[model samples]
Target: MRTVGVEEELLLVDAESGRPLSVAARTLQYAAEAAEPAEDAGDASIAASGEFAPDEVPGGSIEHELQQQQIETDTVPHTDMAALGEGVRAWRDQAITAARRAGARVIASGTSPLPVEAAIVGKPRYLQMVEHFGLTTTEQLTGACHVHVSVESDDEGVGVIDRIRGWLPVLLALSANSPFWQGEDTKYASFRSQAIMRWPTAGPTERFDTAESYHSLVSAMIASGVIFDKGMIYFDARLSHHYPTVEIRVADVCADAADTVLIAALCRGLVDTAAAEWRAGEEPLALSVAMLRVMSWQAGRFGIEGNLIDPQTLAARPAREIVADLVDHIRPALRENGDEELVERQIAQILERGNGAMRQRTMLEKTGQLSDVVADLATATAGLEG
Candidate 1:
């Protein structure tokens, strides 16, 4: 079995006001202290031990994001969903405790509902991004859930990515959690997707059946001077540069831990299904980047409320039907991985209770206040805080 891991970027908000707070640095200091066994152990202990301070965590698991308003947690890769879920929940609670100490709270929101005054992290690379990308880098306050599933080889990884590009939008729709931006309802389920697409290289990618072709395109992009390096490839899904895995980066940071796990299970299933198809000499679908872009836009706009472009025919279909088709297509892989029941249960729950976007809108409608939206977000995140 290919072990899978997840990385979630979360927003730090005021505990009372639900407004975003720029306290990531302070919260991180607290987290580092909490991670250490002794209070006075300090940087030396962290440096000398050279490992995550506790067993349930992993080194480099928690870190600062581009903005001081955001913090990120990464899980140690695992084959069992139970262990992965527990690890993620542990880190989330650690973040919540760390933030609470700083008079802030961590919320798993795709974007802040109130006005965003992004505080860019002071680093050379970030500064370069600010200079190179201008407002696109400065105004970014979006959070995403990235799932990394191990692959045996780069060729297999590229093949999986090539075969799975069309299905990426469905994942995006399932994880749509950002409905409000700048204190107003953007009316789109995932405004964050639209916000992040400002990047020149961010979106669905064309086919790259071989590792050489993928690397060649990445080199070409870098050589063009349009982007700084391979990190900026920003494809919706791509081979991880630092890990022997395929990284799926299309979904928003889910509000619930269960939703995050569900996304991970589905991504692993997608990769496994793709790899099996490749091994059987099945050719990848010839979907155009233009059409895929359209599908992504629709997913972001409607989220599961309206129609979606079915990947098989590129024709519009009910979002539920499309999702059902996806579930059926990946059923064998899910069953093989022993995640079919869990994934189906979570999907049904999502359908019944609604995704983060729908839930946010419901809160806003009931209270007619954005603060209520933030408060509800805090409550939702609190379920996994322990």
Candidate 2:
């Protein structure tokens, strides 16, 4: 039992337009209540008056982000799987209530439904990002499911990330949610994946042997003026500076919280398995980054419709087969973590209907409308809440 945390970046959506709302007024409104702002706070998004569970107690300290259309919710560090679930649920439920009060809905999509004008968070740091990344990072209106798992040290974080490279696609396949973009079928499971990957440094990562080596590389990036800070080294997997954890940043925003929990559980299992193996003097098997990219691209392009490259053998395998195999592979860790049943149930769901991307695509295609997509995503979100 150690610290694991989640950072769910949610989209601020407009009720009427069904598009992203560039309303930091409301974003900050909810943030203020979550954090309990200055004396001028009685105007909008008051905290729901009640006693939060011990798991949700720390979520009261909310902060703003660099995008006007987004809010970042950090779940309290959890020592147990159940505690993590409770904390994530509490933060999301509180977010939903606050959004309702503001007459806006907190939508969970990687990209907005409509083409929105790019706007920063109205903060100086964000302005610096715009200036630094130019169009690549500035125009990114996307979201991700970032998971942080406990690690021994900075070196352990990178160690986990190194071993985690092969498993990143399995996680991405589970969390795919971006099926439609700008109100059209983009023919990709997670179009947001490609959009977000446009940044200078974001994709399936390579193994960095030690924390010192990782820091040296990042330091070089900073010293060369390629990135503004350590924060801008946005790889698919890396050591989290904010916490002592290996942060995996590949998965898209899962439409269902069950999928979110599934991804988190799987993530937890993967890191634990690798760390344990490493402690036994096992070096992580290295896979080709080129093949990894292709596998990820296939996942994004076809979602559950096509096969993915098995990173180990570099063979194309059906997505369904991959899921069953991955679930079986992580069985030991799942049991050790006391999440066997939860992981199995989640696996059954993926087998039954496919991931969120598949379901959302079917929903949209049947109705021949974009509204159906939005409604389906919201419905999935609501079901997760329940």
Candidate 3:
């Protein structure tokens, strides 16, 4: 309940070709105006030693993610939704213009529909990753918008993650953007989710009851050398030891920055409300990991069209109704955050026709080519245009 912020992993793509652009160098060069040595010291990035993500953009510029293809943009902390939107919009618009000047475009989808050739800009860290994780990892170059909400305590972070797991599917369904893969429709809402899961440390996490337990597991995993660093524990939800927030990593990057803000608001609101309920002596409702996995699979495979089992009532509900129910549940948080209208609009858009997957499919059906998918992606990225 303290405040909320977001880290968006954006794909740098060729403006005319829609292919992934290896412009982290050029993009970082553009950010040189703001990148001081002290400001660039982000929690050790997987991208490169020089790669700057959350910190380089003080005034607003694209930062780096773990991969060379990624530009991690961040926001100023805000307790209310309006301030969150303003910060996020300003940052995204700056990134888009900077990317445009470098012959690139910014798209925030969870995965690129077409396979962006593994033409990494060739950094040592990227090379290290390739040697460690291999070609499949490079081939699955995807992006997601990570939302972090500050908590009053470590216990609150754990509890927030516990209750928030049930809603991960709903959030993913609402933000699913990777419909096509390797120039063909993968017939799923978020091929990005699956693609990202290819990594050994990626995807949904096992339930944990305490911060001690979570920290112990991560420490053991990192020590075992399976995960290179703490940040590599890419779970649906994790307590960011780096920050005091329960970070929701389930959502794909929305094509639009507005969509990104909505996702962040909804996520922050849910955590705040759930924490409040927990404080009031309400038991944290949790479903089996099996149930959560299946629901997440349904969301990834069929999106809002698929049926999902409700975690609270144990009854199957249409994904749409469930999403509406979630929006309603988070209304107080959204209203408090000054994003009531956007939260409603984003939910309506998800339930109305479908997510990015549906729109990408329609575009492909109309033109019968990956080129059309790129066009649709461009349309989806419109919110970030300067």
lDDT of each: 0.87, 0.72, 0.72
**271: Cα error in model 3, Å:** 0.6
Ten contiguous residues minimizing lDDT sum, candidate 2: 37-46
Best by lDDT: 1
Evaluated against the true structure, the overall lDDT of model 3 is 0.72
Candidates 2 and 3, the one with greater TM-score? 2
List clash counts for every candidate, in order: 0, 0, 1
Candidate 3 structure quality by residue, lDDT tens digits, 148-208: 8888888878877777788888888888888877776778888878877777777666667
- Which residue pairs in candidate 2 collide? none
Candidate 2 RMSD to the correct structure: 4.5
| Cα lDDT tens digits for candidate 2, 1-386 | 44667777777777766677777557556545664422332212224332334233433333455677776666656657676776666666666666666766776677765567777877687787788778875778887888878888886777777787877887787778887776777888888889988777778766678888899888988899777788887888888766677888888877777777888888888888878776776788767678778888887887666887676777889987887777777789889788889988887877688887787778776987666666666656556534
lDDT of 1 by residue, 123-170 (tens): 799999999999999999998999999999999999999999999999
Return the TM-score for each candidate structure.
Answer: 0.94, 0.90, 0.87
Off by over 4 Å in 1: 37-60, 384-386
Model 3 quality (TM-score)? 0.87
Q: After superposition, how far is residue 41 of candidate 3 from its true place, in Å?
A: 16
- Candidate 2 achieves a global lDDT of 0.72
